[model samples]
Target: MEIERKLLKRSSLERLVDMMRSDGNMIYAPQKKETQVVFDTIETFADMTEDYIVSNQSPKFVAFPKIEKILDFSISQEGIRQEGTQLAAFPPVVVLGCRPCDADGFDSLTAIFNWDYKDELYNERLKRTTLISISCAQKDDYCFCTSVKGHPGSTRGSDILLTRFDGGDYLAEIVTEKGKALTEKYAALFEADPGIEKDKFLAEVKPRFEVEGLVQKCMGMFEHPVWIEQSLRCIGCGACAYVCPTCACFDIQDEAAVSKGERIRCWDSCGFGLFTIHTSGHNPREVQSQRWRQRVLHKFSYMPERLGVIGCVGCGRCSRACPVDMNLSEHLINIAEV
Candidate 1:
């Protein structure tokens, strides 16, 4: 699709932020929290932090929260009652400053949520949200979006993409109907595209490895020792999954006092030993090695085959957050070579 392009001055960008909030849209952007940069709710443009290469966590939490109430149940003398979150009650939101990897990961998450069963809450939230991604200007050893067919300026799951110019200006690539509508509504804030080149300012990320035939290679390595040797240092911490943008595994729990309770849905990780445990005291992924295998296979093999989309977005947050310095790129390269 041909995207609409526009030029926005640094000061005008702040006006856009004000306009979205004045129109009653919830804005989520990067903010400086202590030492780390994180995606958080912002009240004004002044609250936005512009010094981060990437956020501590992905913007997925805006649509798929870490903790969500699935339904509330009540018991009375007459009968039992249950109520669920209403789709109509959801508020509109805008995710700003999302990286390309983070925004593109939404496609993988959407496929999983709308797969066999439609998750009403996730779908509802997605329908009401607009993603505005910023082209990456900085990348590190941990970043490798190119290997996954993604780029620093990708617009896969973004409504709009903003690329910085030399003079504190931004080039806006309106990629979707939602983006066009927002620009049309706030026409005064945007200027006609002056045909300025955007590639000069965008980050250049080298591909880590080729994904072609990688999934097929993984199929034969199910019982390979690489899985065990590579994952031996894993501490069973769910930090990698938590920081991942496409990981959608979750667990449901019933919280009760006696008569009143709520069924809650919380994030889960395949790296955890008990994630696939059965009630009969048997676990499918009994060791860290097996659990690690599931994580890699699901991202590189299962999701791509089933949904036609790669689950990993190459954000590198997992590698950054890993306590044992488990580099994802290294593991994948090893597997591909084997």
Candidate 2:
């Protein structure tokens, strides 16, 4: 679809931030923290690094945190009673300078959270946030976003997309109603640039993503020896699952000092041997290879087959976060080519 395009000069950085901040929105962007690029609240557009590389942690942390507190309860003498439970409203948020993969991952996440359970907390958080994807001018060797129907510079689930053209000006495309509302609110910061058409800038986007029957092919190799041989040296740790953009498995626990406590949710991983251990120590998936196979299957086949779309965003964080060097991209490409 041809979207309405606008122009924002390099000087408009402060203006954009001011506009968003005026509405009590939290603006988060990639900030330089020593050697790594981390996402944090940015008070100004100067904090936005246009040439910033991939963030050490995918922006998923902003949506579903590693650990979260859900509800709290209190008990005295009479009976159990509900205590302070209502959370503060999530003010408007703008995730600025997000990549296409990060944006798509969040969109895919909405499905499961809103499935049968209907998580109102997560839904509320999402409604209050706006995703603004900034086009990537470069692609590293480890990037495989294109393989899963994603691209380095493409915009899929963003409310607004910014494409940097020649000179210091950017071509902006309003992708969703949130983007329109934001643009309308900050109309003075923008000017219609006729030098470039919407498609022209998008034409230059090159993501080496190859989405064939890669996931399905991985499905075919569920019990194959490759898993056993490749994963034999792997230690049963949850680092891979912990760093993956699409890994949503979690365990909820309640903590109570006396008769009442708070309900908490935290991340979980299949790599842990105790993940499937029954009360009687009956572990169906006892080996690391079996655990690893489950990871591949859940990401490649199970999620897509059930959700009608790809599960993984191909962020490469799993490979980067692996302790034993269990690179996911190599395994995926190996199965995909076969």
Which structure among the candidates has the greatest TM-score?
A: 1
Judging by lDDT against the true structure, name the best candidate: 1
Q: How well does candidate 1 match the true structure in TM-score terms?
A: 0.98
Q: Tally clashing residue pairs in candidate 1.
A: 0
lDDT, model 1, position 178 = 86
- Error (Å) of candidate 2 at residue 143 is 0.2
- lDDT tens digits, residues 51-108, model 1? 8888998989888999888889999998999998677888999999999999999999
Write candidate 2's Cα lDDT for 1-338 as tens digits.
Answer: 45667888767856888778877889889888887777889988887776664676777766777777788888879877775434455667889888778888886778778768887666777788888887766656566777778765666888888877777677777788888888888888878864675444443333443555665576577768877877887897888777676778888888889777898888899989988999998899988899988988887787787776677877777777778887777877666665
lDDT per prediction? 0.91, 0.76
lDDT of residue 89 for candidate 1? 83
The 10-residue segment of model 2 with minimum total lDDT is: 200-209
